[model samples]
Target chain A: MSIGIIGAGQLGRMMALAGYPLGLRFTFLDKSKDTPGAQVGDIVLGDFMQAEDIRRLAGEVELLTYDVENVPVQALREAAGDTPVHPAPAILEAAQDRLDEKQAFARHGIETAPYRPVDSKEALETAIEALGMPAVLKRRRLGYDGRGQHFIRAAADIETAWEALKGAPLILEGFVDFDREVSLIGVRNRSGETAFYPLSENSHEDGILRLSVAPAGQPALQSEAETQLKALMEDHGYAGILTVEYFEKDGRLIANEMAPRVHNSGHWTIEGAATSQFENHLRGILDLPLGSTRPRGHAAMINCLGRMPALEPVIRFADTHYHDYGKSPRPRRKLGHITVVRDDRASLDAVITELMPLIKAAEGGE
Target chain B: MSIGIIGAGQLGRMMALAGYPLGLRFTFLDKSKDTPGAQVGDIVLGDFMQAEDIRRLAGEVELLTYDVENVPVQALREAAGDTPVHPAPAILEAAQDRLDEKQAFARHGIETAPYRPVDSKEALETAIEALGMPAVLKRRRLGYDGRGQHFIRAAADIETAWEALKGAPLILEGFVDFDREVSLIGVRNRSGETAFYPLSENSHEDGILRLSVAPAGQPALQSEAETQLKALMEDHGYAGILTVEYFEKDGRLIANEMAPRVHNSGHWTIEGAATSQFENHLRGILDLPLGSTRPRGHAAMINCLGRMPALEPVIRFADTHYHDYGKSPRPRRKLGHITVVRDDRASLDAVITELMPLIKAAEGGE
Candidate 1:
């Protein structure tokens, strides 16, 4: 009767909040008692990678899932005997490694930035020569949100980039000349049914997402993204939400990465879509029929980084929805976010213009 | 920093769910630990009348409110030394007693059913003589959803009605010949700013609310309800949401009763209005700016009683939102509710027609 989660972060907290309305119970496996999910549910504090903890959690609940992709995949397989782990753990393995993810995309005929593995200093030198200059050298494992990455510009910069990333299993990649960055959320069920929310135009600064605008409405761009995502879902036999990030270049969508869970980019769907990604994820994993994925209207979500905003006045804005993560504020931390949805594009644009400054002010900017 | 509610029923649970997105915390006081609110927040298990418990809760939270109106008023006043209670304890006193409620309406020149207090069998006899042959006699307090009252249809039925009602103070009233029953939700904050959600036509079965259709949209009918509610809110210096039920007869709005909390009729606003009543109540109680209460086109909410409905299929309905109370189902107990919202009237009506029988089947009706 209870849905068990491997991580009890804010996403799990939101999943619990969304699930409670449909009469679902929740228990979370978290190493710390201080997580957001622990604030609202039953939690077992233990390391997610520990086999004993995963077995203990599975013994308590029959269905298992993870909010974050950092869980140990082998430990998940041990727990997947009597309990089914949605997203299948293999998807997590693929998504967690940069090279494996790119290989999967390549095999599926999906275009990605050209990349070659670099396991040693000699291999790094060979990959740089093969891929050319002004590329990015990244750790293949455990990298997220621009962390564990170094930019290789000219020949002079290769030594510094190597010095920064040579300690880990690395990949050297070509740079993308992208016009804009966008992402699409697709959900599939056990019955092989699928639904896709509209494409969202995303803007990031310093590798942190700053804003997301839904239904970026370029039909051709969205259709192309959908085709690629549908094939990827079927390839993995995935049963839940999958978010694929893309770079729009020459009016074509090139796949960059995919997340095997409900994503921050889809947060606008809570108010903008008829069925939110969180709800659909639960429904999909439970094998329930997927709800409608249609966008209600134009919506924009602005992330509050570093600190809680001066939200007292911000909430007064019409059609604005605000959420605070309840985590202690720290520099560059995702403290909270707000969404503004409207029936018209002009009204939505006006609100976005008015809100971005407030968001910036909250982040200690001019 | 947090809102303290005197009772931890499902309403408090819903209030917490609504408030969490706005960066608010909640603590609840309830007699049972098994209630829905206990599942989500800090709860104190004690009687609402226990002064020590009340003092303990007040010590922790400076802003106090209640979900259910039946809390001990004097205890609430005792708890209000440094804390402020929204809608005030006096409004609760007025709303609790039928005689006082009628008197308040009369003082404001509001039209209500013709009535007189019946303290004894002699008083009942006199009231029947003065009022008419067909009348309803109701107890003064602690009665809801038709729990109290007996109908006196003829002279021969007087003794039995008096015998059934003689145990407590009562009121004899002439029932209105109404065309339809409708309720309006009006919220006012500390700054005297007021906003009203559109009138909702409500249908009740056995005096329990069954359905509410938002924006009944007869301008003349709505203006009258708004005028009377504004007078009542100003009269009491009320802060928070108040739901006033009215009867529309001969195109004239007749006052029936009012509740001093976020009400069942307004639950449709969670996804159908620009602002939900739970959020507006928090805003009003915190002296924050009230959000817009404009209905988004049309909405209908169906209350599920007695048993849990088969909702996996129901959730797939487009634009339909469901909430289960997370309580064990009991006969005649309100287990949960569903709301169907749309941007057009015909679509809403169509869903309502399609859903009503399913709801009735869930309630063991059809």
Candidate 2:
């Protein structure tokens, strides 16, 4: 069976790599044939945002899914026709806007930082006064990797934040003094079979993910997160992978944002877990039996931003795997990643520390 | 960089899959685009035996390698001009014939069954008389999986065995039947670095491999096999995976044959070891540092002959990985394989016992 992927980025490439062993083929829809996905699979040369292109791809495959979250939901709904689109267009619509996403979390009783929609300067003032002095003003749609948002620290900065993000649908959220960030990656099929990988503790620098370590959250926190995700998935009648990024403060998880796709935080599952998230995502979308999500070892995945480290230096370490996305070097791009698995967390941390210098040196050299 | 593979079978398909993560591309030369390797990589549609086709592929890629054993060594040597070929054509030339292979093994101090070249009926009789009653006559070239051979049990069977194999260049050998079979997979790089996976105990039915269990032999046996393989690789200045199959009789290993590429017995290394043989093969030929060959857990790889079992039923077992080569079903043809990894050997055995019936039932249905 062939799967049609709307956006042919590295995620689609990895998915194709994982799905091939299961005897599945992939066709990718993107503007250019020079993408990571296009390198490994058939390409449909067209824009993913265009309804006509999506329909063409949908017509060629048994099912449709996507890599990028910015795809227009209305186009997807209209183009999918009889072909099933996993993670459903309805959920994509909610995930596209911040206010809608928060409301969806509220309906499931999932806690989030207090927020209010702001459409005008007067509304922004009202939201800031009600929430607190420290708040964030963000464009409600198309924000990712810390872009399209500004921080409001004092009364003087409210206008500055507004002036920066004006003329767009916006949201004001109360500032969260988060202890750490973690993400839960879960999958559900049409048959109602659900499975989840252990929560991964993530660290970010300058709005982009820098590192992730798996099996980080407490057992209670993991179960609580799973319960929350399960309710949300059932509500959307979801299939395929769903990821929710959360902030942990005072032993509680505060909802931050969610993505209806395979996540960077779960990349360690490729070698750390019994089954990879990419393979599970395919299985979930096809309504095949869910694979075991048990952890194989303590794993740490570090993202290679802007430039990838030399392959020879990185692979010299034992149990270390390097992934180059077959992409050209660009500043702050999701160029590639390196994963290291160890018998214990201490060893994993030690290796990550030793390897970080080599990775940083490459970034500096570039 | 792109690597050119001569024959696009399951081994080449697997090599391409493993190399993708290392930021490498592949171009395969084969008769049809419907092959397993062609499904995942670019294909140069041509016959592997044709020198002109091999030259065309060599001109397109940086280096070349072969998947099938019968690649006509003279053609490879002539066609691969300036483009390096791993496991050099010299090794291929020796491995193509049984007599040359036995002589090569002896040169490395590797012991093998007593054998003699047989041309006429009188020569066959003399060989059988010297070797005694249970003996075998095998064609010197292009024989595999129990094909092109006949067994001679007594005097009456001598003429029958000679008649069956008389037309081709042949060899008569004493059969070793005391114990189980095992194979050692080893790799060496141009930089003279070498690594070896633990010996795998294998089982065969009708001279075809049915199952392989890794980390099977004693430490002494493993070290001895590794030493023997190291000597052979050093002699050849090999730069890729090389496998040596043995007949273990009364705790001593008798060399049966050797393959100049990755062996089926090493398939368990895909998940059971820290790095798969396929990936290591790429690293070796590229002269990059070889990966760790440490076994992660007890692993058993079962070949799916003629037909593949249902994906859902096979993946339901935790730690089980399914690999379908996307080949059309043919009687006794190797279609795909399933690998199951466990924390211990006993549990691994138990799961294999449970999974066999399901796998066999599919073959029967087909």
Candidate 3:
């Protein structure tokens, strides 16, 4: 059966590549006629907000899902009548708005940091007072890769942070003294069967993900987080891959945000897991039995941004796995990722250590 | 850089797929527009026998190669001036003719079943008298998958065997009392660096490959064959993936024939090896450093032809791996393959044992 994806970026391209081998064809939609996914998929080029394009995409495929969450919800809702949209428009609506998402988590008895909605000067003042200094002020909708968010360390920085947010619907979240950022990437099928991958500790730089190490060092913390994440997915009747980002503080896991589609943090699964998140997402949307989520080994993923430097050194290492996403090079743009899987964390760490030099060399660093 | 592949079959499609993540693009030449590879690649539709199409394809890419070896030698020669045709026309010339291939092997001190070229009735009589009854007669050129050959069990069957060859250039060979059929697939670069995958034992039915098991059961036997295969390839300065089919009889490995590109028997590498044969083939032609041929575990590959079967059983088994080549279904056409890797022979055997029932179910058998 054919499945239409709403974005033709690298995520869509990867999903298309993964789905094709499973007898699932992909039809991709994007405003750019030559998006990366379009290079390898049956593509329909049009604006995401265009009703005619959404209708055409819905008519052509057995089901509909998206590569990114920025597609207009109203357009998706209209097409949902023709083809089932997994994780549903409601999930995207909640995920799109930071305040709504936090509320959803709170309603489900899922732990999240203290937060207050702020859309105007009065709300901003009230939120700053309630959440206190050292809070994170973020745009309510469509923030990704560390964009559209600011850290407020002092009361004096409130006005500047507010102006940066620019009257967009916003949320001011109380900062948690967390030790690490971990994520739970899992899939729930229509039959209510859920499969969770091992928890991964994510590291970011300049607001973009730098790396994700799977079976994230703390086993008990990872297990506790997965239990809560799966329950939250079941509560929503979510039927697709979901990634819950969280902060681990004093052995307690607190929700930060969620991605309704395959998350960047789970890219290690391509070589490290028995079944990749991309493949599982296809299986979930197709209503097929979910494949295994077992990690093949301890895994670490490093993002390749802009241009991939010389891969010779990484290729020289026995355990380093390279996956170039085939997107055009641009500054700070994620072009691909590398996954290194090994029997122990020590080996995984060694691979990452070895890769640092290669990555630097590729960046034209001495 | 882009490479032009003469055919858009599964091999070419796989080559294109492997090429993409490495910054290599491909333009395909096939009679049919939008063939499987063409769906994800640029297509230049034309007959291989036509010079104009060859010229067009040559102009578009940096190098040229074939998915199948049947492309006319003259066409390849003409394309050579624009972009080098790898494995070279010399290799193809020897490989296409049974007599020439055997003679070349003999000159290299490679062992083979006793054989002689036969053209006329007088020559056929001399060949049979020398090679004896119960020999096989095979048409020399354009034969594959068990076609264009006949077995003579007795003197009475000689005339019938000759008739079956239909006046094509042919060969007569003494029957081999082989215990098993095995093959060695390897790649040689222009710099003369070579890497070889462990020998694989292949099982066939009706001249079509059914399965290939890597690190084939007998270690000593495989090592001996690998050494010989490497020596032969080095002698020819062969580059790209070369597969040499062999027969093991009385503890002796005898050369059978060779294919100049990635062979079906190496399909297990996609999921079972450090780097797939397809990826290495691209690396070899592009003059990149060769990759490791280390098998992850004992790997067994099963061919799926005509229709893709229900994958529930295979998916349920933890060790089983599936790959669908994404080809259109036609009677007796190869659609895809599955590879299973396991820690031991018992687990590997279990997957194979379970696979038969699944295949039968897919074929509508009880």
Scored by TM-score, the top model is 2
lDDT of 1 by residue, B1-366 (tens): 688888887788888888877767778888887788877777878877776787777788868988887877887788667988887899999998999999988889999999999998888889998999689899988788877888889998889888887888899989787899999999999788888999999998888888999989588878888998999999999999998888888888888888999999999998888888998998887888898897877999999888877877577688888888888777778888999999899999999898888877877842
lDDT of candidate 2 over B160-254, digit per residue (tens): 88878888999998988859999999999999999999999999989899999998989999989999999999999999999999999999999
lDDT, candidate 3, at A252: 87
| Candidates arranged by lDDT, highest first | 2, 1, 3
Q: Write the per-residue lDDT of candidate 2 for residues A146-232, one digit (tens) a residue.
A: 999899999999889999999999999999999999999999988999999999999999999999999898999999999999999
Better of 2 and 3 by lDDT: 2
The full ranking of all candidates by TM-score, starting with the best, is 2, 1, 3
Residue A182 in model 3: lDDT: 90
The estimated TM-scores of all candidates read 0.97, 0.99, 0.96
Write down the lDDT of every candidate, Cα atoms only.
0.86, 0.94, 0.82
Clashing residue pairs, backbone N/CA/C < 3 A, model 2: none
Identify the runs in model 3 with alpha carbons over 4 angstroms from their true place.
A364-366, B364-366
Error of 1 at A198 (Å): 0.6
Candidates in order, interface RMSD in Å: 1.3, 0.7, 2.2
Top DockQ: which candidate number? 2
Error of 2 at B113 (Å): 1.1
Clashing pairs in 3: A309-A362
